[model samples]
Target: MAADAAPRSLSGKVLDVLDAFSADAPELTLSDISRRTGLSLSTTHRIVRELSEWGALERQGRGPYRIGLRLFEVASLAPRGPQLREVALPYLEDLYEATHENVQLAVREGLELVFLERITGRDAVRVLTRVGGRFSLHATGVGLALLAFAPPEVQEQVLSGSLERWTERTITDQGQLRRMLADVRRTGVAISDRQVTMDALSVAAPVVGPDDCVVAALSLVVHADGASPHTLAPAVRTAARGISRALGSPTARRHPAGARRRASGP
Candidate 1:
């Protein structure tokens, strides 16, 4: 406790410094942190020292710093994060084993998706998703699955916001994205074809919670070359249903196969 410091809200500056480390840049130098967070060098140094001592950040080899294990320990206590990972890992593994491709699990966080788990096989196509990473709701398969099942008001919010483009095929037009979402809801599947990147395609399905609400989404990503989202949809949907059932979603009971069953017969 500060014996003489003025009582005030916790420092936003500290969070900014921490937020500077992300999936794209997990390690940062003092100047990098200061620049990314818009904090002064002295201020960044001071907060970095405090956070390092507290185990919320750690020093890299010489100068750069990365997020510390202590933060992950704290994050694991969150039900929406690690708890969901614990419940979904087995099914995600099954999906991975069957396809030998990239399998992902994610949840909606406002207008973006926060990946909870990811499993990739050797030789699997590279994808932009990373565990604990965030991506726009308009481009990825899992994002579309979550967005399609979201309430109409939430959908409108996304449509009204600027749609950032990542690839030429990305749906920047509101009408096109709206139609894509409709297709996802109608078929209980989302197909992202060269949307996030030109070389990857993803098929995703929604996972329901005990309340019968879309709480998460599951996906399979593969090389865009000669791949068919329709061919992968069943497997993706099956894994999603299995995870939803594990989460106590009553609707998932209607799933036609065992949770661990692999899709068979092309």
Candidate 2:
């Protein structure tokens, strides 16, 4: 007979409850939480009561419960999330003012990329991403930029794994993706032309931290009809470099004297 499995700890059970909430299912009843977390109704009720009391979950008129603002409060303390966004917002705003397109900032989390922020004009081409949402690392321009500078082992894992296709233009073949990542590194830019949606394209560049390692990616998503990734590359790269400098990246800070003037614009 197989050995019995180890029992889950109280903290693990609590994590299971929190993990039950996601973008698709933002609200859930006690019974729903119990079912999703594989916890007994009594346990679920006890935990939910405690979490609600502690402000981690909030109920709506005896109906389903949703994630609470307390969670966002705690998440704001994360150096890589809110802090990074705070540092990059100015440069991002400048990019927005220049192009009036969909501007996005993202960071790689394991094999996935999580959006930290997005700025879009009312008339900008509609995009499917939302701040704090997670996406695969092989589809979006920001994802590609993050993936290109990822550690070799991380790169190998993504290249060896199955790539998801969001649209007909999404790259799925391992060899092709490998080549694409190489190009992103060589050119210091990544382009996703209708990869996520048939009507949108994005041009992205890497943002590095003080360690001189990429910490995030910045991108501009626009309507594909008249989009030119080349035309947008210079501005995107310049903004990314500015963000890196603001973050104190040594590589960005050490540019030769006149390089800064040239990088400003033509």
Candidate 3:
């Protein structure tokens, strides 16, 4: 076995300073940063100055600081994030137009699904989720689709955690979520009916990568009464297969064994 790598040393104060900024606290004063980071005022100031000079942080008009453009530029280079989104957007837009519903594209990060893009139809059902927002892997349709195809360790970790409930239909039980994931894998699609919102339903399918790993999920959320999950499954599956093909997934190059077997059955 290879030897374990040594941990790299970095000042706690520097990490603390960086951790102070969040999606909610995108901009903060030096005093606010110091309090949030639990660092001394002088140390916070020093590190903030260093980060600002290095283009990782930006000092705004008055005293607040925000993540800088340089960080955004660097983050855009991430292949699994923006790069994947760029390749999938056109296909997602097509699905949205066809269904006239809310279209979402997301990827799994740890046990959460991070929304990369969303397009809302003119008369689409309203949802609480937003772009760049993170959600649990056991709740939303995209989350379920991603969780279904994830590595076994990831599934175990999610099943072992505290599964929070969002609505009456949410799957808070580990056994139920496990069953749902198994069903998703078997059917090639996931359906979350009023799991996240009471009035909406989501249908999702996995987007596989060239390595046969699920890299993302594409979903359409529509009014629960307007469309049946069964009716939407085929469309979502087709779009997902198209995206997987574009990504060079070997599985997408051939029909699924079940389908092939069905075609050959007497």
Candidate 4:
């Protein structure tokens, strides 16, 4: 006789319902969630009601349910999210002031990177990134920096996996990507020219934690046509170091001898 499958845990079912909502579909009817999660309507209803009662979901007069403010409040407490943002914001602001471009802060989560904060000027080039959005760790400047400093196993997994190409300039070959990561490690910066979008370019640097381990990446995205990535790299690196210092990184506290030369140019 075939053994019966183990029953799914209630918490697992709850998480499935939550996962059904996303940036593309921020609101969903109970039936919508049921279909997405492959749960029966009745089971979904019960889970939804419990989540609603717990302030994880909110609905208005039989309308579709949306993620609740309470959930945001809970997510705010995560060290990688708001805490990192709090430490990085002032330096991010300084970078934004200096360049008036799109300044972004992101941290790696597995093979993906999540945006924590962004500051864009009124006339800055358009970018596809959104706060709280997840992006693959092989195409963006921030992603490249994070990947370069990532553990060897993580780097191998990304190198071996399918790399989604968003634009013609996106590097899909593993060998080329491996070389690019090496450059990022050697220079302390990553330049992604027209990788995500043809009209945009980004320069990024890694931000380390108190243990001198890279905990996040900081970047500046600008229009590709007239901008010089080499000119922008030092400023981006400097601001990233500032954020790392604020986060208590010992490496950031000790300035390298040639940092001023790099920041000021030849």
Question: Per-model C-alpha lDDT, please?
Answer: 0.87, 0.91, 0.85, 0.92
Residue-level lDDT of model 1, residues 1-266, one tens digit each, is 12133442338678778889887798999999888876778978899999999999988568689899999899999988999889999999999989999999999998888999889888999887778888999999999999999989989999999999999999999999989999998999999999999999999999999999999999999999999888898888888888898999876765544442344323
* Clash count list over all predictions: 0, 0, 0, 0
TM-scores, one per candidate: 0.85, 0.93, 0.89, 0.93
Better of 1 and 4 by TM-score: 4
User: How accurate locally is residue 262 in candidate 3, as Cα lDDT from 0 to 100?
Assistant: 53
Candidate 4 local lDDT, 37-146, one digit each (tens): 88888989999999999999999998999998889999999999999999899999999999899999999999999999999999999988999999999999999999
TM-score, cand. 4 vs. native: 0.93
In model 2, which runs have C-alpha deviations exceeding 4 angstroms?
Answer: 1-6, 256-266
lDDT of 2: 0.91
| lDDT head-to-head 2 vs 3, winner | 2
Over 1-266, each residue of candidate 2 has an lDDT whose tens digit, in order, gives 00133677788888888999999999999998998888888989999999999899998799899999899999998888999999999999999999999999999999999999999989999998999999999989999999999999999999889888889999999999999999999999999999999999999999989999999999999999988889999999988998999999987887622266468455
Q: What is the lDDT of residue 68 in candidate 4?
A: 89
Off by over 4 Å in 1: 1-8, 31-46, 60-62, 254-266
| lDDT (Cα, 0-100) at 30 in candidate 3 | 89
